[model samples]
Target: MREAYHKELESISEALVEMANLVGSAMGRATGALLDTDLRLAESVIDTEGQVEELQRNLEEQAIAVLARQQPVATDLRVVVTSLRMSADLERCGVLAQHVAKLARRRHPQHAVPRDLRRTILEMGQLAQRLMAQAAEVLITQDVDAALQLERDDDRMDELHRMIFQHLMDERWHHGVETAVDVTLVGRYYERFADHAVSIARRVVYLVTGEHADDYLPDTPVIH
Candidate 1:
């Protein structure tokens, strides 16, 4: 029975990795669809979101079952609880990818990203893919350093997000309100996707160290 219980825990870990892989692929395809205005690819991403959702639902059920049956403690308990949180983050990442795809579909042949902002959007997409891939590695290896690196990656995404807004707010902006709105939404989707990846990485940090990342921060020096 002890061996079987360990296997179940291992299975949960495997499921989380699988979830990350699926969402990472979705984000890549969604980015392609957005850049090229490929409705078919966009639709494919939107459709695959159901798979991510299903995986999350099934993983949550499995985790809950382990908790109820095995009553895991210490590291074992952290594994189960953290897995649930990671699944939620992964699911949200999938949804954000779907949102990107939907925007592409809604815009259709016109392409959602304008010519001037195309490079920035492309970089954001690539950054998102890299972050998710790293997040998956962190989940599988529980490498705390790699997990901390993801936070830096997220900062890059945040910078790109700000760049998008700056362009939209430029005095010479001429993309029209509709294009501005689309760019705003797409930029936000990519930013949120990276945020989710960072959240998952933070959870992994907590899982491995038994302390939240915030716990390690130096206390603000008290002013006299």
Candidate 2:
């Protein structure tokens, strides 16, 4: 029975990893659609969001079952709770990607990204996409070290996000106020997408080290 219970727990983790992959792909495609102003691709990315939602619902049901039937304790208990939190993070990542796709769809024939900012926006999108992919890998491997790296990547996303504001503030800016508002929203969407991915990684760190990533110093020797 204990063996079966543990297997169910593993299944929940597996679902979370799958959610990561789903959102990662959605973000990549959304970035492509945004950059190219492709309505078809944007619609496809928007459509895929339902899949992410389904995965989250299924994961929740499985987790609740484990908690009620097995009554996991210690590490097992932590695993179940963390899985729920990570699932929410992954689901939010998908929502952020959909927001990107929606922006692209709204812009339609024209580029949502101004010409000067295209390169910066592309880099931000790719970085956000890669962060979620890395988070997925961390989930599968349960590697605390890899999970920690997501934080650094998230810092780079923040840098790119700030760069967008600089462009809007420049004296020669020509994109107009409407485009500026759209750019601001796009930058925020990518930034939040990366943030959710990092959140997943931090939860993984907690699962492995039994300490929050902020508090746990992997290099320090324990006094006890």
Q: What is the TM-score of each predicted model, taking all chains together?
A: 0.94, 0.94
Taking the tens digit of each residue's C-alpha lDDT, what string does model 2 give over 1-224?
Answer: 97898789889988988888889999999999999999999999998868888899999999999999999899989889988988989889889999999999999999989888999999998999899999989989989877887787688899999899998999999989999999999999999889898888888888888888888645644332
Off by over 4 Å in 1: 217-224
TM match of model 1 to true structure: 0.94
User: What clash count goes with each model?
Assistant: 0, 0
Candidate 2 stretches with Cα past 4 Å from truth are: 217-224
Per-prediction CA RMSD (Å): 3.7, 3.3
Candidate 2: C-alpha RMSD after superposition: 3.3
